[model samples]
Target: MKIDWAAIGSVIGVSLSVTVGLVALFTLGIAGLSRRERAAAEGNGGGAIAATGAYVCFAACAAAVAYGIYLIMAKS
Candidate 1:
């Protein structure tokens, strides 16, 4: 099978961008957790659910990025 370098590059570029974005989102989630923890300590019930949702989103994005990378690596 002939390899399409342009397609491969595009996939890799997109995957890398996704991975970076997810990592940034994961960082934000962590920050949210820290804020939430402080709020909880200060007697506020906020951020727990949002933090969880953020983590879930980060995981899904990471998985998508990994899948994209896999597609780029796999021969067609």
Candidate 2:
């Protein structure tokens, strides 16, 4: 039996990076939504932009999650 340390390390690094990145993106989406709500209460024009940004962030997070699922399923 042989252990490929480099392959193991790369997989761990990539998985951690993807996990953190998705979490950060989702957090930003939530923050943008909160800002939109605040702007709406303040009667401002910035809510539209914030809403658009929030949607983009949320979509990206969803896509990343779907892709991860596909990768796992593909191996089976």
Candidate 3:
């Protein structure tokens, strides 16, 4: 039996990074929305920018997920 340590390591690295990256992106989106609400209460007028940032982050996350699903379904 032969073990491909390099391939296994690469897969692990990619999976770990993707998982962590997505989580961080999602967290930032949530934080952005909260910040926008707080800023609105203070009449800071910065909520628009924050809301935009949040939307972009969320869209990117959604795209990544959809692409992943597409790739998986493509394999069949």
TM-score of each: 0.54, 0.93, 0.94
For model 1, residues 1-76, the per-residue Cα lDDT tens digits are: 8999999999899868876887887777777678778878898888677678667766876787688779879956
- Give a tens-digit lDDT track for model 3, residues 16-74: 99999999999999999999999999989989989999999999999999999999999
Residue 21 in candidate 2, Cα distance off native in Å: 0.8
Q: Give the TM-score of candidate 3.
A: 0.94
Of the candidates shown, which would achieve the greatest lDDT relative to the real structure? 3
Better of 1 and 3 by lDDT: 3
Please state the error at residue 70 of candidate 3 in Å.
0.8
Candidate 2 or 1, higher lDDT = 2
Q: How do all the candidates rank in terms of TM-score, highest first?
A: 3, 2, 1
Candidate 2 per-residue lDDT, tens place, 1-76, comes to 9999999999999989988998999999999999999999998878988889999999999999899899899999
- Which pairs clash inside model 3? none
**Which residue pairs in candidate 2 have backbone atoms (N, alpha carbon, C) closer than 3 angstroms, thus clashing?**
none
